[model samples]
Target chain A: MNRLFKKYEGKLPLKVINDIKEKLPKKISEAKLKKILEEVVMEYNKMLVQPGESVGLVSAESIGEPGTQMTLNTFHFAGVAEMNITMGLPRIIEILDGKKTIETPMTEIYLKKPYSQGKNIKKLALSIKETKLNEIVSEFMVNIAESKIELRVDEKRMESIGVNYPVIQKCIKASFKELALSKKGDSIILKLSEKEKELNQLFKVKEKIKEVYIQGIKGITQVLPIKKGSEFLIITAGTNLKKVLELDFVDKTRTISNNIFEIASVLGIEAARQAIINEVFKVIQNQGLNVDIRHLMLVADTMCATGTIKGVTRYGVVKEKASVLARASFETPIKHIFNASLIGEVDHLNSVVENVMLNQPVPVGTGLPGLVTKVKREPEWLKNKH
Target chain B: MKNINVKKHMLVPEHSKLTKKEIQELLEEYNLSLNELPKIVSTDPAIERFNVKLGDVIKIIRDSPTAGKSIYYRVVING
Candidate 1:
């Protein structure tokens, strides 16, 4: 075992080597171990990417080809009303484009310890779901003659959301200091403070009151606690990654938001890179497409290689290309050319795009292998004699 | 200074950058030029924590399901 381990020391990681050591039988002969190690080494060799493979192009084609066949539709979450995930091709485009604000920003929040083991999950979900004052109000009557607005809060809805009238009153008072908020049993009355009582001003205040935040975490519109195996995880419709991770009961290590830019700023570029790969793979898999994960990983790495999330668009990764011609090849060729000339930028013609654009042999595959042959020449006198 | 340990959060692969001598040895082993090798930006978060310079090579060790562990190399270039 030691000899086998030493043979593939640097070739494999220490953890894998230890695992192999543990799995080997104590009575196995040296020859048998040698054969097993050889097979393992061969398998390892097969997994490596070949030199000059043009992985970027391969990855693009692999994803793009399958993308054309994907249906453009949003998938509704199981048993969750009005919570539809932007899936299929549109979702893939959103991810690769690195849009700052996605149509449906969501997160899968895992709880820590007892919370994950199906304890107080409903309460936890209620606490995370965002509740605005407007959502719980059954009626909003604008009394223009009295210069006031009467908001009748839904008692049952408020109870279900676990928010009391006092909390709502406090939030309204803090948000709108200019307006006086008075609670009358289950309803809250809003009127202009002694300063101004114009009809227009009261109308504006009435509109603003409807949008005031009441309780619960902001940006999380809904949360559904679903049981998976022995643990329970919450799926939120809207994502506020920073705020969610701050909760003591949340499993910071496992909780993930689908917003790549948010992840990049909050967790760092590596996490964003991983999130991109996972999200892209998830979208493709949801559509029942079979694509190698390595291709997705390459795309993710390229997008986040510069320590920020950049889309595949001309404004993003394409614009960062070293070769001016390569940049021109991606999109907006005339604009790229015009800008490159103005700056006197040089095109090294090193990459595949520029070479292909110029109709020259691309620097990949067989083109990478070149030969330099020296021509043998006879002296001038010997040539004349011949 | 607070160290942002990226590995603690997710399954980040092990990244070890190769020195000049080791890079030279890798080139000889692979029988390829520096340009032929796969490129990773110098600012890539996986290797940014290390004191790596331009033209350095990085060795990435990832745990794969098919293969127990797969080793890959990338040449570090400026972003």
Candidate 2:
């Protein structure tokens, strides 16, 4: 555990990030490995556009004078299909990789506004609904109708309509779960195509599989992909952790590590670290340590994370500068034993971490060598002895 | 007086705060004055149907939730 922590607990330099990539084991079967790295890169991109987060944009005052924050309404990702929502990811990666899916299919919806300057305040609040939003729209309409207000369709929109219904085409191209219903005023009645029916059937099967998979892994919440060649699957078993301990006398450590790695590939390293923390707890809990679970939590945390496990104070899991508050959340204590064991240097931990947010630097195998050097000097003295 | 009796609440589009010149321009563009359009309060619930500025004349778009493109617009009153 110390060795594992030692390997990661500092800011990995750019050279190191490259070195890790270079040292990465290569083989034909390791196409999965390359895919994993690509996914990691993708995760980084997702982090970039993470909403409501501060980003380094040129200050408006310096450029075009101050205006209100461009707080436009987010459209429910204009996706009729779950996969085409990949459009954003694809666009991001294309730019990153210097390859473009420029011709990748897109549907356009034209609102009744001129493209000129002014109150573009009417943002497209929704692109489309994933969970039968037509019902919600119907409810809203019902409310308006209840007031005895007459509703009418915008004739001018139909008159000026130039673009083919890109949204409709995209919906049809998607997994075809769209339900066409008759309305009172629509002169153009669109019938659901046969291809659309097949898609809907597929959606039903997908949903059923999800239900079965979720039911199967209720208790043991390790991600287990349904298929060998698939992406990450968070295995949630209804059975107890005590059951996992009973699994055929397999190489328990290796099996756990492999699962952690699998989760990391699909989800990312933070999740992998979580898997490591959770699995360790389950294993030791089965061992039935007389020490508090919170103490074991600190130890497991000191192993899985950069900082040592301090007591869970009213301020919560105090993380060191080398550690992160964002990832501190991974150590979710069971039963809400809010107050518990205290370990590690509190003052030094504070210097490394400020109030909730770490001020100095993340200990991802980089500069702040204090934690890494400590682990390296100690070198798994207690962990490996067993 | 045999014309349709437009309800007072239906005139939610009449809450213009535009300057006399700007309001006059808008009125002329739509071919109307304060007397022609029905009076509506800015607080009227139906005024939310469109986004119009003070003195801006909006043309309330009625849309069918289902089926083909059917949209019509009327002014929303703004204070």
Q: Which of the numbered candidates is closest to the native, going by highest lDDT?
A: 1
Candidate 1 clash pair list = none
Per-residue lDDT of model 1, residues A1-386, tens digit only: 68667978877656667777889887998888888888877887787778788888888899999999999978888887899889999988998988889999999998999999989899889888887788899999888788788999999988887888788888898989887778887788988776778878877887788888877788998889999888999999899887887788888778889999887766656567778888988888888999999888788878876557889888888877899888877777999899889999888888888888889988898788768888878789989997
- Overall local distance difference test of candidate 2: 0.31
Over 4 Å off, model 1: A2-7, A13-25, A29-47, A372-386, B1-7, B11-79
lDDT of 1: 0.81
The 10-residue segment of model 1 chain B with minimum total lDDT is: B1-10
Q: Each model's number of backbone clashes? A: 0, 41
Instruction: List model 2 lDDT by residue over A1-386, tens digit each.
Output: 22332343232223334544576666434456545545655664565434432221222121112112222222233323222222222222222222212223221111222311212311211111111212112121211112211113233432222212333233323533443423345221223434544545534533332222111112332222121232221222122222232233211222222243333332222333344444434433333422233333233233323211122232333332233333244454432223222333233342222333545663332333443333455557777897
lDDT for every model? 0.81, 0.31
Compute the DockQ of candidate 2.
Answer: 0.01
